[model samples]
Target: MGQDETVSNTALEPAVPQAEASRRRLTIEVVIVLGLSLGQSAVYSILRIIERMTRNVPLSQQTSTLNQSATPDRPWLDLTYQLVNIIFPLFAVLLVLYLLQLTHPRPWRMIGFDLRRPGFDAWFGLVIAAAIGVPGLGLYLGARALGFNTQVQAAALADNWWTVPVLILAAAENAILEEVIMIGYLYTRLRQLSWRWPMIILGSALIRGSYHLYQGFGGFVGNLIMGAVFGLVYLRWKRVAPLVVAHTLLDVVSFVGYTLVAPHVSWL
Candidate 1:
């Protein structure tokens, strides 16, 4: 063969094996990251839902509480515990960023986790928060009325001077962790693997919904829808920051607003 033909054959020979290896590596990476983080949550959530289903009480009468106090009798120690709980889960996010940097030169910007477009992120986030939050509340209420959902106490932390700030911090943490890992990282990796958009969005939505199964069927379905919506938004804008903002706002209202309203109202 001529030199050009020899070089061409050499270059082409390993293409299939290289592509297969790349896909395998990305797949393993995704599985490992998820196993350590939300995938773990998803497993426990599945178990919790099964447990709730087996209980003697109706699902509607049962409750799933969030932001509970770790040490109710000791406020200062409880505060310490709360902060620790809120702060530690984010290590998973750091792990993701580190892994992404191995392949992408600017991983934060690639994932849209930076503050490059504050105004667009903020306004779009508010719009999404309202769109999801109002209907999500309605779905929860309706599901409860029909005895298909649990009474979710969005916030049950004791009234400490630090309660609101802790809740807000928790909200932000959840937003950043979920958006970056779920939409930003997973979507990017899956697209690299040549998966179609429909499958990517659906898979992400399923995982999102699965982790919320502890709350009941309503929570699962509602979050499934939310995940699909958020996934679509990420595809359209190519930005996870807006989704993070929207998630943070939605969670803040659910967490802090519940504490403020639960005491004064008969229905919550």
Candidate 2:
């Protein structure tokens, strides 16, 4: 019996070493991911400040300028605004990730950017958006009805032929950058810390909402609700693609309907 016990103990020794190695590897991966996320976040924050300074104009005035410059004859300026406002920030984030040696070469896998599975959940996400959006829209309208000054009084610039493409690109950039940072990186890391899904989702949502503070209370509330919904989707699916698609679609809907169809909507 003693010899048998000795053999059993010996057998367990190899398994212990393997488990330790596995743990070490996981620790290393977590450390690398955390380092990359922190670095990217810092860089993005600084760039955003610099971007705001360089613009040197309020968002309302900037929107007006962009609208005026978006004429058919001035396609270049319109394109430039699209690149500056939408494309460049995304590029900067990705570039920073690459420089930090954090991004995978496959790009899609690096950001968990899968589009193959637009399953029932994808449709469900849209439904969820509508569920939230409809109520939010009502609330926005109600706020306006109650004489709250939550309206964005921007003119329709969608008459420009170039506007659609620019807005589409903007939507794509937003989908990529926001998801990559908020869900892909942050969610993954938070999970490593053994955080429950609910906590992770809520924390991500709050951070997402807080970032929209400059957009006004309605924007903040809208984003908070959207973030929670998107975070829930991410928690369930663990795929960024469908969320990206859903987000892009929502933005497209807003741009086309709110800006083009009803520019003077009380709550945009």
* lDDT string, candidate 2, 1-268, tens digits: 6755556556666555765665565557655544454334444544543454356564333221112234446667666765677756676456434532442455455444655555753785577657776776676555445433135432345356667776677666766777776777667656655779888788777666555433334445677788888887776666777677777766666655565666454335
Q: Which residue pairs collide, candidate 1?
A: none
Residue-level lDDT of model 1, residues 41-149, one tens digit each, is 9999999999999999999999999999999899999999998998899999999999899889999999889999999999999999999999999999999899889
Clash count of each predicted structure: 0, 0
Instruction: Give the TM-scores of the predictions, in the order they appear.
Output: 0.93, 0.63
For model 2, give the 10-residue run with minimal summed lDDT: 59-68
List candidate 1 segments past 4 Å from native.
Answer: 1-16
TM-score of 2: 0.63
